[model samples]
Target: MEGIEQNPVMYDLMSEMAFQHSPVDVKAWIDLYSRRRYGRFVQPMQDAWNILYHTIYNCTDGAYDKNRDVIVSFPDVDPNSISTLQTVLNDVHEQYGKRYLRRAILEEPNDSYDKPHLWYSTSEVIHALKLFLESGNQLSDSSTYRYDLIDLTRQALAKYANELFLDAIEAYKLDDLHAVAHLSEKFLGLVEDLDMLLGCHDGFLLGPWIESAKELAQDEDQERQFEWNARTQITMWFDNTELEASLLRDYGNKYWSGLLRDYYGPRAAIYFKYLTESLEEGKGFDLKAWRREWIKLTNSWQSSRNVFPVKSTGNALNVSQWLFEKYLQDLGSHDH
Candidate 1:
């Protein structure tokens, strides 16, 4: 299987950029507004560049064994034959770059942000590869495993939520507090949609686990055991690893209109209010502290369990479409 190094264009670009800077000039290379020597092929070229970078990132830090032969082929042509894990990841990276990344760039067309930001993280790619390997290279028929459902769902939700976030940013630029609050609440609705689709209610897992824990807690000596069991059960629902569970905990949503209006909206309102007050007092706001506070608040919301009934109906794909359409409608209304 051919890797990015085997591709002349990508190889040359990577070599040039690698020499020019420590982390490589990824932002400048993917700048869509800038004139490219490759003309119309620039988009594809940029996609290839990002794919190469991501592939290299995943292959770094001893994640990949360079000496190992390809365990999975690029096209995976033969059922009996096996290629290296790196080869499989590279193949998926190329496909992901061409499909998701290129489409996002074409759709969003914002040169301010680097294209690689739209791509999946190295851990995400590794998780997918692990799934593929665990299935003996045979694709799973399960809906959750098919087409990288979890990651794809996350990306879809992020895309929609980001649109709303951008709208909120625009409102902030205009100093329209009401519009910012309104749009930010709508932005959080995307998170609600995710919770519904994932069945993230307390009753889904936590309630049962708590009951089990309570039963175990009857003995004073079993308190620690109960805690361990509860932690194990919760982690199992995630990816069965503390790292992955932490990732999901940070990203997963348990939201509703009430929480959005009461919590997130007020938070943003207070921040903006204080920001204005600080400006009036001739004191510049501490942006670093503000960012830390924002992250802390967001994580607090994410950690909160939804004890309410699950509201999302339909399959994952269906719910995704429904939310996306609703997002479009909301964005349209906000545009006017």
Candidate 2:
């Protein structure tokens, strides 16, 4: 296996499946999980879980459960850049009621996610987020509730950003430079805000990662080397030859405050800048220049030792909720 991951919620299920336990009732256990997850169960929270059960949690793809964000995706004018870039023609055609790209016998980008841009209804996730937030005031003290709230909110915002990215792509096609610039800026700004929200949780910070790597070193040189390895793994991933794409860059992408503000956020900003500039100058976008600059940023970051917060820095619940309402203000009510 290339990597491994698991949902913390699986612990309870695993315990129930132990030899000492009776036959497990999966549905009943899942229902009870909401109660066990948070200190006390609110119907709204349970309703949120049920929605999740049908939506995001319903994924069967073993490759990757989550849909990759636009920041990490190879930039494309259409939904599938890999296909268009491969064919060197606008082979974006409608089929089966959705846009599908015609790829050659061999996909150009060897390192691409096999999943579609979006697999489920983003609106359903927003609805689930609303339900999750309804009991926030009552469950304010529950740490688990706060963590789950932050996660749900992050998921909702990411989905919204994806929508904005699609709009920006459409605007680019229409040659509406103003709309594309505005949409791109707004969505990238969302990434900064997400960094702040994620910074409130320790699990999402970049500090301990570097610190842990440093601990494994015997000398300053080795420490720097280890730190570079740790940083590169999450950013540039590996060196790519002229014929091969960087197979793993951004595959381990995190929503960490320092990483987002310093790496992915700025990286995407550079991409959009070049994109708009190329349009304004009536020239084709220089992909090679972009790759060179991005690699420089990646390597520069890997070598530099920047400080990151190890402890969760703020009230995650408050920060995440404020963000959810700020971006999704038009969501109106949770009556649904």
Candidate 3:
């Protein structure tokens, strides 16, 4: 808390991002926490809660809008009322480190939601709070409902992915080709990490199926039909519903360096090359044909996962280091 207070830049940036038009009802939220009875923990908890809620609200552009009203409408309770909000916040802060608030703010468009201005949904936040409360705010209590390992891993991966994505965007803007290729490989490697952790390795390993599809088809159209069928089957195997598949696709296929430089880069280069060639020959570029070819290329790329041998040694730090080394090696080889 002292460290955070000393560094006002983060809070300032959060305020600028969050309070563009909608000013937070700070007094109302403070009043809500003040009314709660948590003995010695009351005031400190209120202060922490205010900082967290205000930061979240501001940084996320009011995505947690309902929480604001909910807090304002909360009824006063006796000093002995059973509540673990304070405990949960403390645990989250400790586990995630002092800069968790800032990291969370910067890591928008979280893995759960890929759309702009929808990094984290209200329900997801509420669900996390509810789990903490239900578990008596004990991080060690895994007997009941909990999100210790998997959720934390997911959050860590999401944060890393978002950081890489931001770097990639900046590199792309600058048209730094080497940085683009290096960062893209690292991003894809991270995605591979996530896929392995989530047990999505089997479904996305499309090399065998693609080879079979190729062998079974006599014509290009038949090959495409086979590929589509295989893709549909793979989708169904991984996801229970169309909505689930869509979410997976949207969140999984983030616009990272590897994807942009390797997949789109080649296609775009080929397209423009053909355009130039056609112009030189006094024939117009066949937009329809190019579009068809692009679709086929994209589909083929989408069908396969970025497969890499990433060992899970049960140590998070060790695993992260391994991934980093792999990323560096991949970049050195320029093996997009």
- C-alpha RMSD by candidate, in order: 18.6, 6.9, 19.0
- Candidate 2 per-residue C-alpha lDDT over 1-336 given as tens digits, one digit per residue, 9 for 90 to 100: 023222456665676677645677666667888888887878998878876776676666564535367654434232225332222334766632645454333344653324234455566678778777778888868877777777778777876776676576556666789997998899889988888887876766778888889999999999999988999887766676443347676677765668877787888887778768777987777677777777777778878988777887888777877887788867533211
TM-score of each: 0.36, 0.81, 0.32
Compared with the true structure, what per-residue lDDT tens digits does model 1 show for residues 148-211?
Answer: 3333344344444544544554555456667766765565455555555444223222344434
Clashes of each: 6, 0, 3
Off by over 4 Å in 2: 1-6, 19-23, 61-67, 72-117, 241-245, 331-336
Residue 330 CA displacement from its true place in model 3, Å? 21
Between prediction 2 and prediction 3, the one with superior lDDT is 2
Off by over 4 Å in 3: 1-148, 200-294, 297-336
Highest TM-score model number: 2
- lDDT for each candidate structure: 0.38, 0.70, 0.38
Give candidate 2's error at residue 72 in angstroms: 4.1
